[model samples]
Target: MSDRRSEESSGDEPSSSSISDEVWEQFLQDTERDIRKSAPKEPSARAREVTERLKGRKGEPEGWRTGPAWQEMNGRAARRRRAWAVIGVPLAIAVAVVAMRPSLIPGDPFGSTAGTDTATTPLPAETATPTAAPSAAAPGTPTLARPFAGSPALRWADGAAGIVLPKATALGAIPKDRVELALQQTRKLLVDANLNPDVVAGGRPRAALSVLDPKQPDVLDNLETSLRSPSKTHDPLFLFSRFDPKDVKQAGKVVKVRGRITFAKGKFGGVAVHADYTFVYPVVRAGGSTEVTRTIVRRVIDAELPDPTRYQVTPGRLTLLRYDEDAGNSACDIHDGYLHPQFPSQAPTGSAAPSGPSIDPYDRSRDIGKQEACGTVSRT
Candidate 1:
């Protein structure tokens, strides 16, 4: 009786080996159509998560720009998930059928075929957007206790300590010893020009000037002339970072500094040391107001030490090859001997009309370009 029942069951249903490829494909299509008609039309859970994320993004502070890569990825992922919910049915059914009845499809069961891999490819890895640390105050609003609160300089090294020097290496004809001396002198010159409290407070940068060769024709004379009488073409503040003492007073002893110093073979002779740095100074009204404002100065100077054997040069002094600067929060086109930092309460001058694009003083990714007229700043 058991043998008879087995024979009847075998006759009632066709064996897996007997099904043809065309029949198997038709079966998958039929099953997919039935499943599609039954599947819910509502968005999947992942779709709701994406929508919530977008809604939350709208609440972020104004002017806080984040990279678009992460958002773009989220959008792509949401779209892919929605697509798979519909099209994945047929693919999944096809795979299961091939597993249960491998001979029905012929050849390798999982062989590469057109449109077969539409669901298997993985999504690209995502990256999180970088964010600045929290601050006590928003940008453009400065307080004495949190002078650097909203500025990038808040994270920068304080004072001359930020002027880090690299290991001195021999360059061309110059030995390591001379290269080291050049590095040290260059750092001292930078400190004197920008970080010295006396120099910053409208006083002459005697120490900085002493670093240069006095015998160099026009170099010392030009600097002296600029200090004596400043004009648009000749401003002492171009080399020395100074502000009018009568207008503002230092809020604290800290001066935020960040940049790099590099040395290479001199274009003219010995070793050339290039210093590119930005200094952030917090100052208040000379009358001693508690409200604080910051002035940002970026200076790029190229100084060289000539080979003593080849030419006449000053000992322990550098030859000024190039000097360039850009001052932020300072009134434009005002060529006094000082950097005129504009206060929040001060009225805008005629030169305050920006003639060019807005610049972010904290952005050191590129060199500051030439300014023919007044330019606007994106931030303090």
Candidate 2:
């Protein structure tokens, strides 16, 4: 589950009940800035999600054009914040469907040359084919919405904004079916527990840690560093610091999260299954001054199911093998989510802190991240 899964859409139609192109493209640019600014030298995890999603589909979208550079990028960021404040997923989009197209990048979605005329003024030869109408959804490829039952308890958490859980459907014992079930369940765990924003928001992470059968100590350690450090300007973004520590005692609440998960497995590993994930969550900035939300995050994560013989269903558990916070669109970001696909090769954007192995998204300004929100204390 790379950001592409969350960034790009499979079909040409605007599954989101035809959300206008302007609104969607603006969001693309705004989120990209969030990624770029998080770690200037490295690509933003969210940008990678946009890039990877468009990698397959290819090119600018039909009738969509980039706006002027003068317009502030955060203008779209503001609109996005408002959009997330509304619902878990749009009426037409499901857990896995995040739309992606070349026209998404402000002036150049694919980093290609820009066209001068409006949609009706078409005459450009070089970009014609690539920007043609979207291809039809391949025939017979069934698309269904996986149901999710949100954790009722989360509703009571103060400062809690909203959450996007994995899409799930009932499954049977068939080997083929088990793999899909495992993948869906794995995603649920990844978004809710493993990528639990509550940890950074100053809430307990037991919900996430509880699901790891063969726990990875790095998970908790990294989270502690991300939560503890204290830098005011470049406040910690959960997307960048999987568990990267920061300095703080007060912070913001997780307002919204955008997540995607894909299942995978095969012969070499004795029929095991695993999942890849991309998450984008927004935080209402810390501090008591003015209650404004500024951080918008996009992250990558990988989870593997334990040996089949020991697998359980009621509460699916998996080994926390890899959690690469802000792991941009590297070829290595995606884990096998489909049958027999090879795992992508992933490397750290930069060296991890030796004294503290997981601190990430180093900000040159030394403005790394924020502390947990009001009314919560460190569990470390």
Candidate 3:
């Protein structure tokens, strides 16, 4: 029994001493960490947050070590946290730096513009310029992004409607005077709207929304809405529609149609056109019970529509103005969606179902706000 007691005591004494030594070693390392941190050096924002989070001393006195093993584990956990804090703080800064200075990156990081490439396909020098035919750009006019597709310019007007493509084939086919061109372009846009095309340029199936840019389509839709209510004043649209139910309704049949373009005073190239559209409505009677009937119709409709120069045009970007606004290089200048919402005006109400399938061949992408006009957007 004595031998066994001696052995038991011997084992217990060393085990307790060994545990105490390990505890002391951990405490010493913790003290060294505290000492290293004692000096007042500037801490990074993240490091400062970490320091406040883990506030306490290491290498505490012997009495402080008398708690559960979990207490020791917590101390180790805190030291690990401090190590990560030092590494993570710098990593966060690097990412922010990259975002702000995209120019520092080697290539196009955000997006690109359109029509700068052969994609739009410029006209060849060998092709003879027709009288007053549309071309890339006129002498005084700003350089256009693209050129006309081909000649005589109106397959629809001459071929379909039996109306000749206006021989305005003079001065880039764009009149020299801003007001004249504005009225002329407005007349053409209305004519195009009546035809209900995807997008029109010089009676040629050329540019998409860019030819009209952004505002012209809005003018057309708004006019259609106004003319639907004949009681409302729209002398200009009626004149432009040529008084045909098909033309004025812009949806039915007609006996006759004709019109002329007028102007509203404005600054620079920002002039508005008041089109005087005139037409006759053809009424047809159906049924053996009803007697034959004929009707004569003449109504005048008016609305202001924009010319290309009315909106600010950069190399690849087209800026839009609101109903009561002038186009400028301000934050208020928007460019997106047909009749896009301006700052004060929220998005115009629209039903998920369209009244009719839009003539635009392709849907405009929701991705807008591109700095360049249109280009191949991608990473280098």
lDDT of each: 0.59, 0.28, 0.23
Residue ranges of candidate 2 with Cα displaced over 4 Å: 1-177, 193-197, 215-254, 267-287, 291-293, 310-316, 327-380
Root-mean-square deviation of each candidate, in angstroms? 26.7, 21.8, 37.7
Can you give the lDDT of residue 215 in candidate 2?
A: 32
lDDT of 3 by residue, 23-44 (tens): 7467556644543342111100
Pairwise TM-score winner, candidates 2 and 3: 2
Top model by lDDT, which number? Answer: 1
List clashing residue pairs in candidate 1: none
Candidate 1 stretches with Cα past 4 Å from truth are 1-140, 350-352
CA shift of 121, model 2, Å: 27
Residues 1-380 of candidate 2: C-alpha lDDT, one tens digit per residue: 11111233344553655567798667756655443332211122222111010001124322122210111222111100000011112211322123334332234322243343122221221111122211211111111110011111111112212232333333233355455555654545545543456454445555554555433323444434434552221122332323222312112333223323444452212123333222322221123322211122333444554334322211345444333333211111112110010111212232221111121221111111121111100000
TM-score of each: 0.63, 0.33, 0.23
Which rank order by lDDT, best down to worst? 1, 2, 3
Candidate 1 per-residue lDDT, tens place, 1-380, comes to 00000000112223635767689679877866764553211101001011111111344422223211112212211110000011134333444454455444444524466346322232221122113211211122468887875565766788987888988998866789999999998998899989999988988888888888764556677678879998655567667878788978888999988778888987445788888787899888798688677777777777877655444456667876666676667665556767666555555432434445444565565454344444555445
**Residue-level error in angstroms, candidate 1, position 286:** 0.4
Report the Cα lDDT for candidate 3.
Answer: 0.23
Best by TM-score: 1
Tell me how far candidate 1 lies from the true structure as C-alpha RMSD in angstroms.
26.7
